[model samples]
Target: MIQKSIFYTSILLIVVFISSGFKPYDNQIDKWFDLDNTDEALYIFPSQKNTDYTYLNAPFKGKFFVGYKEAIGFKESQNKYRKVNTLGYMGKYQFGAETLKSIGISDSLHFLNNPRLQEKAFVTLLSRNKFILQDYINKYEGKVISNIKITESGILAAAHLGGAGSVIKFFKSNGERRVKDEYGTSVRSYLKEFAGYETKNIPAIKNAKI
Candidate 1:
């Protein structure tokens, strides 16, 4: 009786393993290559997509951009806008260096110029009980973090290292401004793939220890 039970259990385990096959736990490569019909392709592959969402997402999520234009006459111009956006996820936080690079962002951009974005993301993650930026800070051994200013245009952020030379300027304008917004478009795309990967592969990788 014992031998028969052992054989049945072994067969069941073999069947389960064979059915599962080789599922990708971290399919960042696959997700990167598969460009969807959303703004994520643009932000992640700006060169390939030749797109910028800095304007669109800025307003709803409260973002603005500061720029200057030449005056047609003998008058000065003064206008400034900030772009804002928000993205939500339903699972674990799993962003990293390779993923950032795959999306056309480098360590300099991720670690340096994107502090505000990261912090806001961290806050959002905390709200959802998904992950914590403190975990990254702990793992990375105390990286620099800067406090950001919040306004109607959203949260202003910068890194001490790469953002040193960056500046925001105001200009006066005599006419109304009209332009299309596409900043938050990519937020949807990013969330889709990000959530998909988190839901699909994260468990397998976590459970591989046994």
Candidate 2:
């Protein structure tokens, strides 16, 4: 009786092992272990079906052009699409009436309401300013003035704050001229604060249209 019971127990263990081997293949945990070259074996490839939030997860601005634009926009109006300041600067980058018109936007109401147009205006203005200040940028882009490093992005930001003319004047005076807006935000401050960002992707075009 003991020998028969032992023999039955051995048969049951063998059957259980074989059944486990025949079960469905579960790649849930092992799928991560599957390596590939596209994702460099680090993570699963992003598929439209399952992948969401492919944006760069960083919170603060980096050295990229997108980060540069978003950072300037945040400072201008906290990235508000329809924000209008007390001085009547419109949209995300806070363009004045004349500034809007300079970019071929005559309808202030349309510019104030249209976010896409406002964004285009910002980039277009950058291109225009870059063209206007090409001489100054070429002259003092890498130089240090008043303990502040002069850069293309800085010059463009200052131009946005005041104007391309102000940026040129500041550079011409060797950083001596301390021009300020109605709110007392100095061109020098914008130059220092917005220094060192990627803005070379914007081509220098005279009379850049929206």
Candidate 3:
């Protein structure tokens, strides 16, 4: 009887191992894995589907208390503090070297490695944009451009994506002139996506820098 029980247990273990090695093809299994409810007994393989809930749900669907700057950081680099894009944009906010220098961050390596500095740089750049685009914000806020409502935070976010100059052209053209980065992400897209955030704490300082 003992020998028979051992033989059965070994066979069951082998079966489980073989089953776990095979990839799951069923869509329901894929969905179960996608939801992240891991079950060892289910033997479901991991799915490569994107897990970013933001994409799965409505735009700007997240915690109400999430700061706009942090949200932009998430969008820019998925909030990876040490991330560097192919074009050499660095840090959580994806600051170009020139922009980093403008904000008093001269060391790209140090800036990329330092999360706090990157956050400060974002605030500084936003402050600078807010100062530079104050008149535009006052004039354009609450105005509709291409069916999207304009807001101060939106303008600042667009300025962060392209530049204050590009944002100005965008506004001056009444949404007729669209500006996109090398990746083809448009300034209007940033404005529209990042709108409706409370950024009043970022005080506008003339020529703001870290």
Candidate 4:
């Protein structure tokens, strides 16, 4: 009788422990199981933290691989030399027909087919943006807006994404004037991601060649 009574007590204790969310040390399972990755906890956790913007606050130094014009190209079209998006933005740098025409690329088919032309077009656009936003870059570079330290490369990248006018507005408003493309990519995002790079080689020209 005592044995049976002890067994019932033990079972009751186990049930109570489980109901109270208690588990033995050996029985503890990972709380992160099957949880969506976008969870705040995942973002805050040290082990799982994203390092995408770790260099945002770092000193102005160039990065390799996806740096300079190539980074912009990758962001636009994943560096696909022969690709064209649904919006008709063509080639590796995803230049619209109008933008291409402005840079002296009249034939969209020829521009899309020629990888060299695409590269030149990117440089030409960058040069043009540099000229247009030179004052803003000089004024805002090294200044922090919305916790992000502005850099020349960052300003240039933002200009590439949302035009020189949009970049000027973004900085002038202290990041209050939010500008995002159809892909929901914001100027701030580009500024943070592409903060440090060497673009001084590309001269600011009134009419850069494509």
Candidate 4 lDDT, 1-210, residue by residue in tens: 999999999999999988889643452234555447654332222333355336443223247423566666667776788998888888987888877777788999888888887887888888988899888888888889998999888888888787788898887788998899777889999999888777767688876765
TM-score of each: 0.14, 0.71, 0.72, 0.68
Of 1 and 3, the candidate ranking higher by TM-score: 3
* Candidate 4 off by > 4 Å: 1-66
Model 2 clashing residue pairs (backbone):
none
lDDT of 1 by residue, 105-205 (tens): 44433433454544333233222221212232133222211221212111011111011011111001111111111322221122121121111111112
Instruction: State the TM-score for model 1.
Output: 0.14
List residue ranges in candidate 3 displaced over 4 A. Answer: 1-66
lDDT string, candidate 3, 1-59, tens digits = 99999999999999999999897565343232343555433444545566622362223
- For model 2, what is the alpha-carbon lDDT of residue 192? 92
Model 3 pairs in collision: none
lDDT of 4 at 59: 28
Clashes of 2: 0
Total clashing residue pairs per candidate?
26, 0, 0, 0
Residue 209 error, candidate 3, Å: 1.3
Candidate 1's C-alpha runs over 4 A off are 2-15, 18-24, 31-56, 59-210
User: How accurate locally is residue 172 in candidate 2, as Cα lDDT from 0 to 100?
Assistant: 73
lDDT order of candidates, top first: 2, 3, 4, 1
